[model samples]
Target: MAQHAAVDDLVKLLTKANYDLTLVQHRLDKEFQQIYPHNANPLKLVSRIKKIQEDLSSLKEECRELLAAKQDLIDKARTTLVGNRSLLKRMQASSGLPLISDSDDLAYTNLNQIINEWTVQVRPKTGDGKHDSDSEDINQLLFSAIVQNS
Candidate 1:
């Protein structure tokens, strides 16, 4: 029960972190959109975009850390529950109690399924510009603009 509670708490944390990341990405998208329409100060705009990219990179690192922590918690909970179930089965068998066969196995399967679903849902978006091809064009525009200005 305690392990279940711990896992629940970690899931909540992971959800919150994912939400925070979404907000950050949305902000970055908005900022990126505004950068292209402006005809003023290409150097300044490039500098600003570079800073935003740096911040986005940092946020991604944080998301990765949170994901890793959530994975660790799930692993620990799985290990502890499996160990407890094994011990209980031994105790029950020694006491001539009727064995409940494969109950732990079912629980473990369900837990793994749930964790896999959450992992797929909560995985952070990669920061590589390939995800948004427009970003590549924008980078080229910025480069050309800077070169022309210089």
Candidate 2:
């Protein structure tokens, strides 16, 4: 009777251990399934990460190209403005007019006044008078300078 009772107690302990092990395994499997569903491909996660990095790199490259284009445009406009200012100074000197100082807003105002006077003088006084091509040339130069300054 003692031997049979010991065997029966041992069986009960083994059965309980097995049930606990089974429960733990099921819990671990559930957690794993939540992270990576059974129907989904795990390799696609790495591919998605790679695709995001590629998109970020492309966006940075596009920003660099746009900045370069804007800088090029600004440089060209500055060059044109400098050329126009130099031409205006030369015209003033060649016409025996005093050199307008290169400093201050007052100088620019004086230069504009001179240009206006020249334009007025160049126009034909009589309605039938022939237009001087020289006057037309000066008018075009003055117009370009005004546009550049503005």
Cα lDDT tens digits, model 2, 51-146, are 999997796566455544544554465467557878988998999988766665474556556544654543433345454445334444444454
Stretches of candidate 1 above 4 Å error?
1-44, 103-106, 115-150
Relative to the true structure, candidate 1 reaches a TM of: 0.44
Error of 2 at 7 (Å): 56
The per-model lDDT (C-alpha) reads 0.66, 0.62
Task: Report how far off residue 123 is in candidate 2 (Å).
Answer: 51
C-alpha lDDT (0 to 100) for residue 14 of candidate 1 = 100
lDDT of 1: 0.66
Error of model 1, residue 19, in angstroms: 45
Residue-level lDDT of model 1, residues 1-150, one tens digit each, is 999999999999999999999999788767766875664445567788999999977965675555556656766887898798889889999999987767556786787788666444333333343323233333334334434455
